[model samples]
Target chain A: MRLELKEVASGYGHRTLIRRISLVVTDGEVLCLLGPNGSGKTTLFKTILGLIRLQGGQILLDGEDISRWPRARLARVMGYIPQAHNPPFPYRVLDVVLMGRTAHLGPTAAPGREDMAVARRAINTLNISHLEDRIYTEISGGERQLVLIARALAQEPRLLIMDEATSALDFGNQLLVLSHIKRLAQMGLAIIMASHFPDHALLYASKVMLLKKGQVYSLGRPEEMVTEENLKSLYGVDVKIIRAELPGCNETRVCVPVCR
Target chain B: MAVARKQGSLTNSLATAEGNYRWREIALTALPLLVFLFSFPLGRYPISPGQLLTILAAKVFPIAPTWPATLETVVFQVRLPRMLAAMLVGAALATAGAAYQGMFKNPLVSPDILGASAGAGFGAALAIYFSLGVVGIQVSSFLFGLLAVGLTWALSSRIRHDPVLILVLAGILMGTLFSSGTSLIKYVADPYDKLPAITFWLMGSLAAIAPRDVWTALVPILVGTLPLYLLRWRLNVLSLGEEEARSLGLDTGRLRLIVILCSTLITAASVAISGMIGWVGLIIPHLARMLVGPNYRELLPAAILIGSAYLLLVDDLARVLTSVEIPLGILTSIIGAPFFLYLLLNARRGWV
Candidate 1:
């Protein structure tokens, strides 16, 4: 009774971009997808989120096929955190987060006290409540990324899919966001996040799926599969794996690309 | 820490922003009423305020008629209808402009984004070329305005690209087609009779507004504006752009279609009655946004109030400020462009 994609195929009209991809995501687990560009990472996410039609196989959410579920209902069960976007108008951060409560409200109904309360709770949890009243466009890229995550949290979905969630953040914000991602998993939310950094997967992901050329190359525990040999094959860049101990952080393995 | 205050929701800040101009809003609302009251007697009729009230009351209720019959006619037949038409046209244009700006996600776009003004102008020109009566001209103008927008939508829908870009390109194409049609008709008309009529109508004035014009414009304006005012919050979501709005579970296609339909109705109705009063739709929404923040909930009402009052003031000036009344189309640009430029030059906050 969790998210499962069985032999799923999706693409635009008459052109199949992704074919026969299978993955399972359960509660309290974080699945990090690592891939290069043109590997169909985006098409896979869009298909799972029901943004595009799935041409083959079934997507089961908690034992129910949800490939054709209404978007309004899908919004209740799953939330998507897109890459940071600069809205044309300068909406306040609070207002942007409050938009996450749309599935709970009717078409013409304004967000009520209850909905605002939920939004406020999400902002507080992200520890960026100081940004609630600031103009969203004027904020830094890192802050915008956090605000997007907070907005997804406000939706209170069972599964959260994040596309490049931490790529835009500064180093400190990267760590903070990684910790938050781990904390959300601890709270029993299933998370599937696409990431460029395999080190992030090593630090936070319970399962890592390495995608290559529109198919899964490897899927297993990060420590077992993220060897120096595999990363070099995946990215065409020579890389070295090292165990490092740093102050205030546990002794952990890190992936370092070997310079030519 | 300082983040979590004792306040309950986001409305607390919104309430404070409203409080910033509580008295101002009251004054703006009262401005229309004051103009309506003082306007009754200040015309060529020269009726006093007391007589104006008595005449108005006598019309509405079965009271003892103390006012002169001529005064009653002036109050009911001439001043009342013109004043109502001016206010309605102003309010309609302003609200529709604000809606278009929000929906298209660009502050520069006005209600004419769908080519409503050009289409209506061409329709009026064609009617004049045929020597149609006043009512026939207005009806034809209103229908053609809708037709132009419908054509734009139809063409744009076939492309399926970025919705805003496609709609805008189609609108420009249709706008050019209709406006050139108006020009062709102008060239062929009798220089003395038809050209002057088309030119004056295009220049725009509320000087000859009749009660029937008011009645025809009011129904569509009210009907169109109700949905926009009620669903204004949805506009915030829409202004986020289509992809983001869809990710938030909003039906962007349906919401956009409704907004275009309502805005098209109001713009066509106003242009039909008042001709091409150009800047009310473009500038009033900007002024409203500066006064209130970009929150559509407050922005829409603010535009309506300020627009009605601003146009009413301009129409009053058109009546008494000169021996020969200046057209509203000319006056609006003369007044609006400088004020807008001043805002741009000495801007404290970015309008976006």
Candidate 2:
């Protein structure tokens, strides 16, 4: 399915934070939304997920207007991986993932064998089978992120939206997750992710949209849109872009800050 | 998935394999049935277990009834209904308590968190002061209990920020309001006839429960309970906080409405029948949680059985341990407060 946003505007309670933004993401494309803090990135993501009311304009999924779709019907077609949260109760990992199938099960129905099979398949696909019975609270942050991804995968959605999914992870875990996210897009899932790092977009994103001061700065292929001047203008920081080549890894550009 | 679930160290002592609590559940179920059977014969009427069995059998199967007419009346008309009322009250309070704890996402919550007990108390006091009969008192209590919660919900829904926090605050306000109203009634009542009756009603008992009161309360209690039972599994998701639940496609507002309605119905029904039986609602669900983990699918049913068994046992002790009847509320508080402290001190054992 293709998600097309036309002149969408959104914010909290009469105050329009983001306005007049248009974008289209199709299957097998990774749309990386790059913005500084308070630049309407989170607000836009919430609007797409229907967590907040839309201020104006229209959102269409596969040529159908989805501006006011029921949350359950919307959930069946779209999956979301929010930032990791500490649950007050310690649910089993498998049970947490099985919640992704809520749209498929009856309101009162327990997870049947078929639903369990689907959950098991998701756990296997995410390589989290070993963590299935473990208490979710006792797991490490990296493991929790993987489990959440497995939960979204269990939903079997065509469109995947993530909000700052890697902002809390360490370097090694961040690379581990970013590569996995790239692979998911390669497997024909349409993905929109907000990230603070432009180098990640340069390395992994098919398209990048830079948001600044509640408006879109630029939108295009990462190679064409991302530049040294734009990075400085977006973040108010001076930086140098260098090509880094390492053994047994692909050559890539890295962003390094320059002190005055 | 590949089944390589080695039981971890943290869960080694308290947790069994998932789905392997079947034996413990069976034991819990058996304890309740034993308590129910034994409770029937332990009342003030001089009847042995064998004699009780004979009376029951003679009734079910038409043999020559060889019991005294007075014994039969005491057994069937008085003791039997009281026993059933005790069981029903206990089960309703405990299950409602469990649902409220999960609904509010706080283990400290009780069935009366929404001013139910206080409202019922005020209503009963008002009824007694005006010389309302038994049914009048019950209906008034039920209606006021609902009114208290309805006021709380209405007040909280107006504010959009931090809805749960506002709801808890509203409940506290309503609780204080109704409790003060009850106190006001007590202060001016004629210290002879109406005051003692109001005091007794507030202390709570199953002494006045007849087959009719049981039938009256039973319908609402069962009507309230069916929704909770059918929707038990969903409670786990609902307890995961509203934003997360909505992300998982749960209609959280609707689910909360249903849960609040059911819990209020059961709580109001029980409090109307027996005055303000305390501790059972707060303590029994915790015991259930300690035995089974926090999965609502298991926890809710476990709570119902344990609550039924516990109140039955407590009622027996209330009658047999004293000459004149001891109030149910006092006994429960005397027992429930210490257990609550213990649970708080050792919260690692599944209170979370």
Candidate 3:
């Protein structure tokens, strides 16, 4: 499935945060949206999920307008992980993940043998099966992030939308999550992620959309979009980029931004 | 695909486990009901349990029946209504308490937090001062209880964008306001006669319930409670948080309104019938949650059954343990507060 945002304008009432935004996320690819702080990445995500009403234009899933899709249907088709949502209760990790099966279960249907199996497999795939019985509130921040990603994966969505999912993670956890997401893209799930890290985009993204002040500043392959000129323009800093050889790919480098 | 198979097996195992656990829950619920029904026969009136059962059965299905002594009339006319009133009020308060806790997603929240208790107290106090009859007190109780809930709802609505904080603040504010009004009413009442009457009503007793009062209160409670019973799944979704509930295609705004209305009605009706019973509402739901997981379908019914059983046992203790009938409120707080503390410290592992 392909997601097309054509001239989509949205915001809080009377306050247009994102104006005339347009982008595309095709199947079997990872499109990373890189932006500076307060650049409306979260707002763009909310608009796409129909949490915020669009002031103008439309969003299309495949060939149909998605604005009319019910939220339950939308949740089934597009798995969303919103940065870090703290559940008020101390739910078990497995219970949290099973919520993803809401779209599949009937109203009165108890969690059947099938639902539990799916949850365990998602946990195993994320390498967090040991955390299943652990209280979600008791887990560390990185482990919680992995569990949340595992929850989204359990939805079996065709499209995955993540809003700054790794912003609170440690460096190692961030890399681990990005690699897992990259692997999911290889498995044919369309992934759209918002990130503050340019290197993460440069490393795992097949395509990049650079959002500056809620507008699409540029969009293209990561190699062509992550130039020092674009980074300087988006973040207002001079960044030194060094090319290095990684274990498997030539697309390895380091970005050291020198604040001026 | 692997994930799907894993979730499938986990849910399957849980279902079978739940099936077994469910039978145990039913047994726990049934034990209390049986004991309570049997208690009615063992009281001051020496109607044998077998004879009481025969009498009750004859009332329902009469082919030919034998009547007992005049004391049987005393049991049926005097004690039965009061006992049923206590059990029903207890069940109503506990059910509403569980609903509020789930709706707010806060285990600590109770129906009384909305000023309904204080409002009912004030109304009952006013009715006593006016020397209202049984009918007058019932009307006044319903009116003032509804008034308090309406005031709390209005105050909370002003800051609708942040409902939880607004709800807490509104409840506290209204509770304080109504309590002060009750104090003022107490001061003005004739200290010798009306003061004692007001104080007794405030302390809460089910000793004076008439059949008419029972029918009046029970109707509204059942009317309010049935909808909550039916919408338990929606309540489960609500516990996840308002944002998540909306995302799951539930009209959270409407659901919240319905829950609040039902709970307020149940609280008011129970208060009218039995004065101002506390602790049962606040504590029973937590105990129910501990016994079963936080699943609302299981939790709500369990809370109701356990609450009815508990109040019956407590009332029996209040009567049989001493010649004097202790205020049900005083007895419950004495037992409930300490038990609540124990649960708070020891049961944190199971709580979410």
lDDT per residue for candidate 3 within B1-352, as digits (tens), equals 9999999999998798889897868786796678687668645556777777777787789637576457556666777887888788889999999998877888888888888888888888889899997777777887788899899989888773657668778989999999999999999999999999889888888777777777898899999899888777557767877656655445567778888889889998888878888899888988887777676767888889888888888887766767778888888888889989988887866453
What DockQ does each listed candidate score?
Answer: 0.56, 0.50, 0.34
Off by over 4 Å in 1: A245-251, B1-28, B41-45, B60-68
Clash-forming residue pairs, model 1: none
Candidate 3 off by > 4 Å: A63-69, A84-86, A104-134, A138-140, A154-156, A258-260, B1-23, B41-51, B57-69, B158-160, B348-352
Estimate how well candidate 1 is docked, as a DockQ score.
0.56
Could you estimate the TM-score for every candidate? 0.93, 0.94, 0.87
Q: Which ten residues in a row have the lowest lDDT in candidate 1 chain A?
A: A67-76
Number of the top DockQ candidate? 1
Q: What tens digits encode model 1's per-residue C-alpha lDDT throughout B1-352?
A: 3456645445697788778779777876787788776665665657777777677677679999865677777777788898889899999999999999989998888888889999999999999999998988899999999999999999999995788899999999999999999999999999999999999998988888888899999999998999999889889888988766777777788889999999999999999999999888888888877777688877899899888988888888888777888998889988988988886776455663
What fraction of the true Cα-Cα contacts (under 8 Å, chains A to B) does candidate 3 also have? 0.24
For each candidate in the order shown, give its overall lDDT on alpha carbons: 0.87, 0.87, 0.82
Q: TM-score (chain B) for model 1?
A: 0.92
Question: Given the true complex, what DockQ would model 3 score?
Answer: 0.34
